[model samples]
Target: MRAIDITAPGGPEVLEWREVPDPRPEQGEVVIEVTAAGVNRADVHQRRGFYDPPPGAPPYPGLEVSGVVAEVGDGVEGFRPGDEVCALLAGGGYAERVAVPWQQLMPVPDGVSPVRAAALPEVACTVWSNVFMLARLRRGETLLVHGGASGIGTFAVQLAKALGSRVVTTVGSAEKARRLTELGADEVVNYREEDFADRLSADVILDIIGAKYLAQNIRALNTGGRMVTIGLQGGAKAELDLGALLTKRASIHGTTLRARPVDEKGAIVRSVVDNVWPLVSAGALRPVVYAEVPMAEAAEAHRMLDSGEHIGKILLVR
Candidate 1:
């Protein structure tokens, strides 16, 4: 199978597309003939050697995939050899085929195509686990999402609004802010021009750009609010105000979708399959894809993401 591997630690240029061994299912795993893969910031980190895949995970970059099952291993049930599914993977998504644990597979929701489904797993699992499962976002509350036009942020906005929460977002441009509003954000702050904390107070904050926004995210929260951070797009090191956190009775939780256990991710996937998947199928929430690149152009996809020239998810079609 053709796969993208990091030749050495550096920039996107290090990512090389080459033919590798085919992925075969081990016990309790399923081999997916990958149709599409989603590009993410973590993929960039992996190429730079800042992150490594866990034990037993694929060495190549890729965190999620949409494809059809080609083979199933022992102990895997409820999925056949021809089922169309999407998986939240630990790595190895940048390939023609990938072996994913059965626990990570979920049916492609109605009205969603394989291309669009490729964009769902990472964002859905991330937003559901952090914003809804962890933070417990409530209706009538104000939710602030950093990187509003981003993959996770775009999904965060739609999900927040669908649950009847008021949505706000901070973005790099006026155009992106406007797009966020169209995607159900009640207000959008130009982070480059405005202070998000001063512009709006939120009952919950779903942040993807961490550290750089930590102090201000705390200040922007309402009393007894929850702030769930899932990324560190901005520099990771920052000071925190212990007094301010205690004063507001706020709780700050930092999580990474990829680092969680398989069982935990399975639970989250089940939750989405039961609830949120229907919303997407019903068009209450929509998949936002900016560009669809061929699987061989993994490096270019990474380049586009690092450049931040696009909005929403970038899907690499196989």
Candidate 2:
């Protein structure tokens, strides 16, 4: 089998595809002959040596993949050889084959191809966990998403809208704002020209930019608002105004999907399958693929993502 290895990580160039030992399913796990892998910003961070795979996880960077089951380990049921599935992985998705816990595997929704399915797991679980489960974004409430054109942001926008939330989102360009509106955003803020916090008050905010938007995010929240920060693209350190939070009765939650315990990640994956998959199957939600590159060209995929030139996900296909 061939897999990507970060050889003294520094940039996308550090990702090297080379022959590696094939993985076998462990108890409760299944081996997948991967067909496609989703490229994520976390992969970029890992390639740069800023993030490390959790203990006992594969060193490769991919976090989600769609593939055909090759083998199932003891104690695993409901899946077997030849089952087409996608999985939310802790790491090691950037390969021809990966071994994953059965709990993380999901049947590809009807009408979605394995290539597109690769883009769903990470974004779906991330959005479902942060915006819906953790933040409890209720129908009719105002929800704002930063980086609206991103994989997570796009998924969040559609899911929140389909669930009856009035969605608002911020993007870097007018073109992206237009696309976001078409995707069901009630309001779109061009962050390059307009401040998102100035014209919007949200009951729930899904923010990717951290420190740079912290104060503004708090100010933009309505009373009793819940703000979940999932990415720190704008740096990690920031001062919080306790007075403002107290007055608004608001709370901020910082979370990451990668380092969580397998059981916890499995729970989120289950929620996505049970709740979100229907929306996807019904076309209320869709996998937005910006590009599909060959698995061996993952470095170029990373460059495309880092350039921020593409909207939605960039998949690496076998």
> What is every candidate's alpha-carbon RMSD to the true fold?
0.9, 0.8
- Per-residue lDDT over 76-188 for candidate 1, one digit per residue giving the tens place of the 0 to 100 score: 97999999999999999999999998999999999999888999999998898888899998889888988888898999999989989999888998789878888989988
TM-score of every candidate relative to the true structure: 0.98, 0.99
The CA lDDT of each predicted structure is 0.90, 0.93
Tally clashes: model 1: 0
Clashes of 2: 0
lDDT string, candidate 2, 16-84, tens digits:
899999998999999999999999999998888889999888989899999999999999979999999
**Candidate 2 minimal-lDDT segment of 10 residues:** 7-16
TM-score of 1: 0.98
